[model samples]
Target: MLPDALFSLTALLYVAATASFARYLAAPADGMDGAKVAEEGRRDVRLGTGLLAGAGVFHAAHILVFSLVLAVCPVEGIHFPLSVVAMLTVLFFVVLRGRFRIDAAGAVVAPFALSALLASRFVGMNAAPSTQVRSALLPFHVAFNLFGIALFSLACAAAGLYLVQERLLKRKQIFGLFKRLPPLDALDRAEHRFLLAGFPLLTLGILSGTAWAQKVEQGGLSDLLRAGFGWATWLTFAAVLLLRAAAGWRGRRAAWGTIAGFASSLVVLAIYLGRGGPGGHS
Candidate 1:
């Protein structure tokens, strides 16, 4: 009951945060009183950030209590992956939003958190890994992957906003939303830094997952497809970084690369969750 209540409260917090961010993005900037509009927008961002931080705390509590009630490690079950990732993503955004000046990306993050939270409740809620596929390394693999994916989600948000802001600049329509977005360079740098931080974790996750798969000797089609997409995600990010260093790819090109890589990661996650339950795969 306590977990359920926490869940409900957390959901409300996320909803309120999402609304706050939406209001910030939609706030008019063309009026003669631009100073007042700007101040109001900043207030909305602060409120959204605070609400998201509170939601993250409640989210962690819900996960802990719910896992205890079920007698399962949060990292051991397929059920908790999305929820954990969403929580980490929110926490990451709340921490780095100010530093990176990417607070505007909250418009993407809040709805994503809400969606992932709801999806987690209904998907694989009772699933657990089978004995055959269970291994000591499973938690490490999942943890690394979850954290990497969370960072990738943030990178994607920044990259996406960068593209929007860049397009607006190109078209010279810099009045409303454009004025509110973080500078293009800041978004690009944030995206790149996020990808850089996440890449090593993702590499570790892939290595651990490979070792676990070999230990179980699992070569099913689903496993193959998941591995394929996983590698594709890694390779895409690698190329993005490599090209940026070698060919000086930045801004628009780098943003698109980050988005593409994140999309691949999402495909891998979708496959994982779509495999029915814990009996499916590790």
Candidate 2:
């Protein structure tokens, strides 16, 4: 009963925050002066950020209560992982939004966070494995992957904004929404840094997953496909990094690579929760 109520409350908070962020992105149809727009934008962003921060607090409480109710570790299964990833992503965004000057990007972050939270309640619940199938490495694997995915989510959002801003600049269209977003170069650097930071955690998670898979002897075409996506996500980001350093791939090329890598990562995650675990059902 308590869990249900908390979940409901968390959903409400996220929905409210998402709404606030959407308002934050609305441009004045009247062509307001630059100073007036910046002032209004900052007000909306602060309210949205405060609401998101409140939602994150409730999100953490939900996880704690859930772990207690289920008598399971918070990191053990699908629902918590999905929830935690969204919460962490929110926390990270709130902290860095000012430094990165990416307040408008909250349009992407808030909605995704809400959807992931909803997915936790509806989709990930039934996918929990039975006790016998549980592995010690599972918590470690999920924790690291959750962190990696959170970073990847941010990287993907930044890369997407970078692409949009880049296109606008090349066409010489600026001011209005473009003026409100983070600078193009900052978004690119933040995307690259996020990718760099997350790659090692993803690598570790994959290694642990492999060990667990071997221990359980879970093999077949489904497992192979899941593993393939995991590997593909890793290699795609790796190529992005490598090409960036060696071949100077930035702007559209690098943005595309990051988006491709993020899509592969999402497939890997979707396969996990949408189906089941490593031994996903056909």
Candidate 3:
């Protein structure tokens, strides 16, 4: 219950920050003409960043509490996995903030929004069954999968934003929205880096999952179908990577591929959870 309260508060703060970031992006400073608007935008961005940072700190604290609770009690259901995903997603964006102008475009807020929505689903859902596994490799497998999803989810959000920004640019419809977005090239570059990071991690996750399944005699035809879906997601990304290399697939198509792949992966996760995973929480 404490964790839930902390999570909800963090979510509300994030929603507020998202709004502010949107405002900052919509209004950038021009020399003399838009000076006042730009100043206000800057203030909004600063405030938004501060709020996001606060939310992140509180979010980490909540997770720490959850970790302690799980250590003493049984870790239940989708909440833990979803919480881990949300926390890591925010962490990844925070790291990228140091290197990119992503803050200017409100990219940080979107992932939090996604996380919040996903987490909230547990409000009414049944708890996941806790299963004990005694293997050194299990932790690594879980870590890789969670972090991979975090990276890909960010890429998905950026791709969505890129598509919108690209379409607006192509149509010569520069307005408030245009002012708020980063240059298209930068978004493309960031998305590429995210994909590069995510694909390898995802491969590790798939390999680890297969190994775990095999150890438990779970590698039958059903496992094959699940693996196939996982591969399908990977192939989608591979195709996007290939097109990016040869045909220069830059914007919307790339984003769409990321979304598709992530969605498929989520479905696979749902299946695993529904079936009661061999040792991990089902």
lDDT of each residue in 165-269, candidate 2, tens digit only: 998899887777676777898899888888998899899989998898898887777677778999999899999999999999987899999999999998988
**What C-alpha lDDT, on a 0 to 100 scale, does residue 129 get in candidate 1?**
66
Clashing pairs in 1: none
Q: What overall lDDT goes with each candidate model?
A: 0.90, 0.83, 0.68
**Model 3, position 239: C-alpha lDDT score:** 86
Off by over 4 Å in 3: 1-5, 25-38, 72-78, 105-134, 219-225, 276-282
Model 3: per-residue Cα lDDT over 1-282, one tens digit each: 987788677777778777778667655344433446555666887787777777777677777776676552212334455666666677677668547566564545544654554554553145443344434555666667778877887777677778888899899977666666666777777777888899898889888877866666555544566688878878888888889889988677887887788787776655555545434333
**In lDDT terms, which candidate is top?**
1
Error of 1 at 155 (Å): 0.2
Q: Which of 1 and 3 is the better model by lDDT?
A: 1
Q: lDDT-based ranking, best first?
A: 1, 2, 3
Winning candidate number (TM-score) = 1
Candidate 1 lDDT tens digits, 118-178: 9999887656667667788888998999999999999999999999999999999978888
